[model samples]
Target: MIDKVIEIEPLDDLDFGKVTAELRSKRREQDTIVLFHPSDSCQENLHHFIAGAKKIHGSMFDYGVNWDDLIWDIRGFESTTSLKDLTHASNVLFTQDNGKGPKIKVSRKDEVPFAEPFATFAKAFVTHRHNEKPKSHSNHMVAIKALRLLYQELPNSLTPCVSQLLPEHFNKAISCAMGTQAKPTLYVTGVHLTAIAESLDEYRLTATPMTWKNPIPRNYKHGGASQNRGGKEAKKERAKQLPKTDLLLFLAALWGTYEEIEERDKALVCMSIILLLCGFRMDEFIGLDLNCIPSREEYDKLPLEIDPETGTLARILRIRVLAKKKGHWDEKIVPHCTVDTIYIAVERLKALSKPQRLTAQIMLEEGKWNRFLEFDDDDYLTSREVKEHLGFPGASATNTISTLALHGIQRDPSSLKRKTRFRVGDIHDGFCDRYRERISPIINGFGHDELIIPIWEFLTLRYLNQYTPKERLNVFAEPL
Candidate 1:
């Protein structure tokens, strides 16, 4: 209720060391997002948040919040604007207490870059934008960030109220932003600037100049269009790029005669073909279930494509994919032309990857090693049930022992046959540098012992084999 005041406990001076140490660097550590907890007691209740990366620009950066629970949501406040000063902000916001909208948020009091009129306007604008029913939290930050950057760029004397923001201010922001920001970010700023500029038209200050113009040129591209447009030219300029057309052609040609290639290497070719056909992102493809493909009856139910050569119906397979960019479960269907080619590759990959999938499913459900492979720290690999654990099919018994040997898995002379040949505990914990090459979720180019990592890295991660590609080459000595 507006009648009641809300109090947020700030962090103690103990964090003063963290602030001082952080600021002492030649440049601000922009990458770190500081978590300030006001109520040091309960973690489940997340109270406030800051885009804490941007500290108060001047001497005020030294301040710290209560070291316990960081609770900064904008809805609980008494008045949105006409605040006397930043520090004079009223404590009227709370997670549980009810009355909402446009309250003075003490959350970023120290973080504001300006004084009086402009500072109040910035905080009020951030709070108001945050409560806009249509926008998500991320978009709320975009609006707040664009406003802050504009305020920071503008000269100190100009304290243009929220209703008085001009196109010129936006232009200045974009011009300065371009120097520090990537084009994609510039595009987002330009969009919110246009929206904000247009909204100010209704409340334009008659005493000052106003032009509701957008900073981004009408022709400037945003989102996917800009990314894919002229991508080939962009590709040439990037430090790492796909190989030349000639090289790609050679690879495709090599894969064309894949039967002639080693069976162990075919998985890579299969993954490539599957990706090309399905258009799944690397993470999406790798996370697929063994039964990802629908049965023939299911495909038959989908809209049929007419064959070009013959007058008959062709089955279409609509694959459900985890569409990350879209932030939802989505579906994709391969082009009819490559249906048969892709089917074979996917089926082959399924059979090859089956063992890992089985063990991975159980690990996924249990969040740990399955019963067959689970053991005490002193347990030795004395069970024949390892077929339930290892990326079972690709590895042979001999290579399994060799890989185990690489991890310091040793035989106990009192051991039995193949089962007790190696110690069990080390296989999960051991890190072998020579074979540090990890499988890429998209195109798994690296293969040694049929993806049977001694540590079973993918199996170890309980996220259903959401393997990430290695960002850099391993410098460890090569294994023969």
Candidate 2:
């Protein structure tokens, strides 16, 4: 075999090319051996190994030259100067695939004991082995075993000599890749080092250093666009439901008939509607006060309007009423009389819940009496006092909402003898406003006598008229 040098031209005048040129020039002058990694050894995939080499060179292996430059003389001569010849000379050893070469079969049972972790690292290693190829599902088993060996051996071989002798490129590549997952990231050799440390007194072991890279995209979505796992699924499912009109009626009937629910249920429902309609998060829902409710007058001034001349008279009449959220209320509303149900509901709820006014003398007397009152005096109400009155069941807000939504009865508080008479009225006001905004256009467009809507949409349409029903449902409903 003739030791000849072939000048490989630079692809670009970059820092990388400069580095390669320096290394090649030095190697040619000194005749310090240059090895071209073979394509036949289990580790012969030049692209994968080189990708890893490049990655490492950028980081901990900055002083190390890329193996690509050493292969200049062997580029076109496949039979004589190839990766196979280099493998025979043992200048380059691959991260073996089972006991077989590069294209061998991978067996699950033959995998390292920590199979999942081993496989995870193996995939990453193979990715580097194949020139950092985009990960695919093919031949994952082989990759797993190779990583297991790397993780098993690298760390316990001691510092100075062991670390110096080891290929820093291989070590760095393995460590960097492990950082990509949500696991106890074992450095390319940390786990192996720790295990080996027990048997040998010569080396030190440490966990893989925590490393990170920019996130890579994954196929988290299961199916089509909106039908995928998350918010899309919720939207799709909500769209399939018969519409809000019927759902609200059902809920209203349930509220009116079920007497078991106390004021707590009413409060929870109030918050739920506000969040679903308004796109409020859990914390926002919990923090709401009575003040957020909009006035009926303000609601009437919203942008929603219906043109009386466009559709059939009966059709126009049937669909003219619509719902509107407070934010979308604008000045362009025409034909003065669009009715807003949500605003009406809020006003009604507030009226029923308002405290009765007292004369000055009576208030003075009551205050004086309260000063001498005991725990059972029936005057001052503590947080516990209110909860007891409302029959609240839980310690935390999450549990409280969960309990109320599950078994609580819905009620129209504006009616006599119902704690939600206040909320019941508010619902009507809010619903009316939302209905005016949402329905009138569709009714004027299609000329329908009645409308069908989802319960969540009914609430959201009241608040913002922005989110779809499924989004509202996710905000409003718990897992149950």
Candidate 3:
């Protein structure tokens, strides 16, 4: 009722003092007034005034202020806001909406449909997960999409107060998905369904035990490959199919075919090389900040002393990145040679601009960095831009990889050894395999004697020694 009655104050007539006083009076009378300001500065001032009011009112005053609504109002302002501000405000609104919980918009007549109670349960489930177990924005979106799909799939004849969701209904959904959808997609859908059932059971939304199992089988074929092949085997298969020569040819074509490749294409080439060598996820590569690379001070501190035994550079460059899978910040150190190559590539890309940093100004000059203007330099490259550059028509990472592989095949017919297609994951696997084959022997030899290994190799060998065995045995499986 308060949400329905509250009116947005005009930006020109906004008075913080008057609004705060009215809010306090309303609180004393056990009434609510949700105030909305169209200006960010005014909203900040109101927030401060409200804080001060709370201090004076001894914390008993109950005033409800919707931060999301205020942000929406600021965004809806017609003439004053810039496009960048509007985009940022829209993102903020979306994030806030997700935090509130899942919302289902149904008409009055269809409000109590067969899956109506499930919708209610879903809202509660999302709210609880949002508060207790936070997830990434992408994951949240997937959950919401899965719920919507489930709702649409349920039969209309079922009542709102249904006692159970039959297995046949789930089977029907799976059957409908077969041949039309990838196994991974169906698997993820099954996972979301299981999560929903478990949450409902946890919250006592269902009287019967809603112990739903994931219906998607692990060995289900997805594009001629089993989903259960695991990362190592899949990587090995991809590497066998995708010879290093193919990637090399693609790079050659990218750089040498044209007398003067566009600066953006050059940047793309550099990006691809770094991604392949560093085994970076697309998100990790794009998320890199200008400052994330070693600063001059940090570079000077790098161990460059030559090893007496190996007669090689004694240090490697450690580039710190926030890995998405780890859910915490971690560092990825590259060999000195790899670091040098990346530095050169980055410098060349940066040289295209006057700012000498990878900003929208530089990346967008060639119309390559799509949507880069909407974000700050600290954020990762937009998914849209990455997808566009990678030749992926769709938004999914899988699509990007698939398209990249297809493009590689189309561009260099002579380079590919097998008809089997390559994937983004294959790049990572190839890098790791090559590192093991080429660098692992040197490392093993160093271990045989009291050789002074370079710091990078030393660290790398230590990690491999400790983890590689278990990794092979699936002790720490990579997330699919």
Candidate 4:
């Protein structure tokens, strides 16, 4: 059964000024919570408001004012009071018995001329931003940081609002950021600003004020020419320092050393090999449940499928990995293992999976899981423990360096003089290079049309651009 149809106007179509007026009218009529969508954009707007308030009033702006608190405060404010009184009440809530507490008074003369417009704009902006598609966490963070910087540049006496923004303000803010951050970072910040402008434009709040020419060039080398040059030289040096033969010898030495150490150390080395071979990110494997490992039956079935043309065993083992970007599970087909390293590693982990060991593993994984895994894992493992296990980036680089030293290979001084350390990522790069070398001859012998399945699977797994061979080669050659 259907009742009378109630058609709600789309927020984008509604006039921003009219909507704010309606909201003000509603506040005057009733003191009740108004429902608003808790989208990322709305959340960001609330965050910006609180940050602006803090900058203006410091400790006077209550730290406990969340979304509901702000909503309720706005709704309950005395309609006849000046905007200054509303601002003061919103910033500082008094809970003492109404008349018994310190008598609070606000004068209309003390009010900033733009306070009312600011409040109206804030409400309208957030409402317009509501129910929007969510942006990535990294994108949201950049937006918040940009907003915070913009707020800091504003005079403390005035309330912050989107309408206050100007092209000059953005230019100045971006210029300040450029002093400390790289061009790529500035470009990313510019992207955040553009996103904000787009949001504002959708709401018809203000014509996007971000018309300033972006200082960072579109084709600008990410780390500058010198750094890029140094990176290529370092990559070559690493490749020369520890070629395939040296890498195998290093692994053998590591295995021999692990035999003398604890079971945990042995498990770590095995995991490291799996990570290198399978191209698994540290975060992907770190929190993996023991159940993720294939059973003996499953392992037995792995090599059953064979390619009709080449008579080569086809990939059958598939593992579910968590996609960090979308927060969903994606199936990653296990690549052809050149050796029995990953299998041995899986078995070692299974053998080491006692209740205490599982608990420790969970703790380590949870502690190490971060936005970029850039933070120190010292809380989970000590420097010596990390070195012994070859877990951290620094440890991996040190292992390679030390292994090269043992082989009487003279390490290039330039390789060790970089800001970023060599990591398991370097090993992944080398793996891709080797994989390409191995596959190129096969592709040359048999046309790509004949080996389409293997080629497609390989390209998909590696996240390579399917249509562009140059892009694929670049990705394969580039050090992650």
TM-score-wise, the better of 3 and 4 is 3
lDDT of 4 at 321: 53
Candidates 2 and 3 compared by lDDT, better number = 3
In order of appearance, the predictions have TM-scores of: 0.43, 0.25, 0.45, 0.44
Collision pairs in model 3: none
By TM-score: ranked, best first: 3, 4, 1, 2
259-330: candidate 2 lDDT, tens digit per residue: 555543553454434333444444223222233444445544545435554432221111112222221212
Write candidate 4's Cα lDDT for 1-480 as tens digits. Answer: 889999999878988766544543442222323232222254354445444433433232233335333232322211211211211232322111122212355443432222333444433333333223323223433555565455545454355566556667667777767775666777777666565555443332332323344556543345444454446776786677543887778877887676686643665677667676666665455434444547657766666676443468775566655434444455555665533555566666555544333322222334221221443422232223424443324534455455323433343333335322323333333333443443332222212222222222111112123234323222221101
Question: How far does residue 328 in candidate 2 sit from its true spot (Å)?
Answer: 16
lDDT of 1 by residue, 1-480 (tens): 477878755765257646533433322233323344222221111112222212321122122222121233322121221111211222222122111222334343333344445454444344334333324334655676566656655554455344334456777877866776676677787778765654333222212223445555433345444444466766565535545678668768867898898755667777676776677776556545444567656666777677554546776566655454554456786677776776677676656555544444333333333433547646666433343354444445665555456655565678777455444545433432212222111112112233322212221112222232221111111110
Error of 1 at 264 (Å): 9.2
> Ten-residue segment with the worst summed lDDT in candidate 1?
471-480
TM-score winner between 1 and 4, please give it.
Answer: 4
Report the lDDT tens digits of candidate 3 across residue range 306-381: 6444568676566655465664456786665666676765555444322322222222232222223344433332
Question: Which should have the higher TM-score, number 2 or number 4?
Answer: 4
How many clashing pairs in candidate 2?
Answer: 52
Model 2 ranges off by over 4 Å: 1-216, 220-250, 257-260, 275-281, 300-341, 344-480
**Residue 152, model 2: Cα distance from true site in angstroms:** 13
